[model samples]
Target: MVTAALALCVRTGAGAVIAATVFLTVLSVTLGGSVLADTPLWLPAMPAWPLTATGARLPVALVLGALLLTVSTGLAHRELSRAASR
Candidate 1:
């Protein structure tokens, strides 16, 4: 998804969103992995020690990060397609 966003940013010259999208992508992956590992069905620990204590906040953060990425991707795609048609 980050890759797609980067491509869109490049094609549309929307460099401003690239750093933010990359950061969010990394954050979402980290939180998602931590949440998965926290589950009883998975392991008790993750390599991300800093995230180990996020507790319930992890889920909220993950969801919001995902939402931001989704919105960014959609807007980027829309802009890319619009640019292509011109």
Candidate 2:
């Protein structure tokens, strides 16, 4: 959700861009264990895991969520800017 929201909010008014970004993120995550798909590693720094393990998924999600929240909060202009938009 954070990824989707961030991508959609920051891109150049291109809805397809965000959709593609999320689609690629999910697709790459599934095809983990490769050199390119290193977002979510299942192993302990040896190979990519891609949210297959709870240990990897939990921490990644936590940190990513925190980072996204911080960015949106910092960039938002109004109180409702980050929470809601047209």
Candidate 3:
């Protein structure tokens, strides 16, 4: 949904979104793994976390999804308004 909003409302290309998503996911996993492994990180417990703790990731995901949804709704609303005026 986030990617769709970026592609549609923000006018980003699908290919660009795919490429960026792949890159970011790889980067996130690498950094997160490094942090979890206790390697020398600029910020300990970073890059990787919703957290390694038990039962703590869902709320973060939910909040972030809600925020993204809100923004997407606003964009969609604006788009609809523009279409209506035309």
Best by TM-score: 3
Shift of residue 15 alpha carbon in model 3, Å: 3.0
Model 3: residues >4 Å from true position, as ranges?
Answer: 1-10, 36-54, 76-86
Error of 3 at 49 (Å): 7.5
Total backbone collisions, model 3: 1
Residues 1-86, candidate 3, lDDT per residue (tens digit)?
A: 56344636445456766776676567667755654434333123323445432255546555755776788777767765666687
Global Cα lDDT for candidate 2: 0.51
TM-score of 3: 0.45
Which 10 consecutive positions of candidate 1 have the poorest summed lDDT? 41-50
Clashes of each: 0, 3, 1
Residues 1-86, candidate 2: write the lDDT tens digits.
Answer: 44445545664345865676666566555555455444434333312333343564767755756776777555544434645575
**How close is every model to the real structure, measured as TM-score?**
0.44, 0.37, 0.45
**RMSD of each candidate relative to the true structure:** 8.5, 6.5, 5.6
Give the alpha carbon lDDT tens digit for every residue of 20-45 in model 1: 56665565466546556465412223
- Which model is ahead, 2 or 3, in terms of TM-score? 3
Comparing 2 and 3 on lDDT, the stronger one = 3
Could you tell which candidate, 1 or 3, scores higher by TM-score? Answer: 3
